[model samples]
Target: MVRAGFYLLAIMGFSVSGALGADAVERAVASCWACHGAGAAPKDPTMPIIQGQQAAYLEKQLDAFRSGKREDQIMSSMAESIPARENARAAAMIAALAWPKVAGAATAPAPDSAIACQSCHGADFTGGPGPEGVAPRLAGQFAQYLEARMGAFSRGEIASAATMTAMMKALDADERAKLAKYLSGL
Candidate 1:
């Protein structure tokens, strides 16, 4: 009888903990929908679409934001809201979501400079395993957001991405803009 009671209590404990974990994960990702949109694209063109991004890339960015390696007031605070233990879970959840359709110019011819980007961001810029790590998908991302990020890298504002900083610095502003435009139309 004692063993039976103990087993029942153990099962109940596990069930409760599992439910709590689910709730915590939900809470952690709830804020993302505000800026990232419920199921579609973000309301602001400046916000990069996070849905369907590589889970590893998303997790890495979350860690960077939490550690201040990546600079962004809103992102820093938002990253903090997700408990460190749940970061990977949150990223996986987001990555599992379908990539939202973005209305934009049709796919443009790739510029010569784009060859360098393909080395890390995949041949199609849909992202995959790379020399540095898992690269985020740039295909169909916001042109404005990409240009701004590229500029920031060139200025060395994003201290977390040393390789990106060097590559961006090599390109002039016009070249960066062209690359961003081309990538966004993919």
Candidate 2:
């Protein structure tokens, strides 16, 4: 009888632990999908498509957003609710999802604007090389986030010392919009 009781208790314990783990993963994924849907595009033009991004890069960005090191109202707000370890797990999940192709019309920047951006952001806008340190992979980033950053740079919210800020200053509103659209499609 004691042996049977112990067996029952063990089974219950295993079931409870399994449920909790499943719940954690589900919650984490739901939180992320609120912004990055499996197939749905963001309502705002500024939000980037996080699906299919590098897990490490996504984790770093989430950490930055959570820490307030990267300032963006929506991202910061979303990151706030996620714990550090959970954020890493969520980022990994998002990174594993497939990226959707750019839908709708393709908007190209003016020749002059294109030239200006290529000087730093690269002709492809995949960002410059440097795993150790340098430009980030801007390709397929959330459009809203990119636009917000550009706007911040233009308004001097981002310091001029930052290379991004300097480049952003060179772009007018039209150019900024064009760049955001182009980069998001990548």
Candidate 3:
């Protein structure tokens, strides 16, 4: 009974009155609830988590996709579909969100290649300083999603980051899988 009340209370905050009174940021944040899942923790393994991604990083990626610098059939079209003016607003909206909980994360071990990764992805893989500023967080990514991306980089299908290409190549397919598996579980 209490849980139901709590849910009702939460929903009420997003009710017509609340929504009608919301500012731009609130509306923008709500726009992502569809494909990215309710709060940006994607249920699909093919989707990347954007709930707590760095604003700059997300903006850069969006730009890359829009400009054809990064080639993802879905993202390229999606990025282009949005007006350039709204890019920063969307990124900021997503970035302001908290990182979702990673169940069983404590039981996950770091892969051998995680140290090399830390230079860019940070010690916690929750992002940190990079030569370019912000690096995307990879702590709880989906293995399949990570694997596909690493493979694309290794094969030169995606060359946005030369460093990532080199790293993926050095890891090889097996090591990449291991790294992805470990990181995703976190």
Best by TM-score: 1
Of the two candidates 1 and 2, the one with more favorable lDDT, higher being better, is: 1
Q: Candidate 2: list runs displaced more than 4 Å.
A: 1-23, 72-74, 109-123, 127-137, 140-145, 159-161
For lDDT, candidate 1 versus 3, the one ahead is: 1
| TM-scores of the candidates in the order shown | 0.91, 0.66, 0.77
lDDT of 1 by residue, 1-186 (tens): 999999999999999998988898789798798998788889898888999999999999999999988878999999998877888999999999998878655676677899988889999899989887888899999889999999998988877657888999999999988898889898
Question: Mind sharing the TM-score for model 2?
Answer: 0.66
Clash counts for the predictions, in order = 0, 9, 0
Instruction: Name the lDDT value of residue 87 in candidate 1.
Output: 89
Ranking by lDDT: 1, 3, 2
Cα lDDT, model 2, residue 56: 66
User: How many angstroms is residue 115 displaced in model 2 relative to the true structure, after the best TM-score fit?
Assistant: 5.1
- Per residue, candidate 2 scores C-alpha lDDT tens digits across 1-186 of 999999999999999987787677667668766656557666555566677666766777788888887787888877866655677777777766776665663554453565666655566665544433334556666666777778988888754236666667777887787777777666
Candidate 1 residues lying further than 4 Å off, grouped into runs, are 1-7
lDDT head-to-head 2 vs 3, winner: 3
Which candidate order results from sorting by TM-score in descending order? 1, 3, 2
**TM-score, cand. 1:** 0.91
Error of 3 at 132 (Å): 4.2
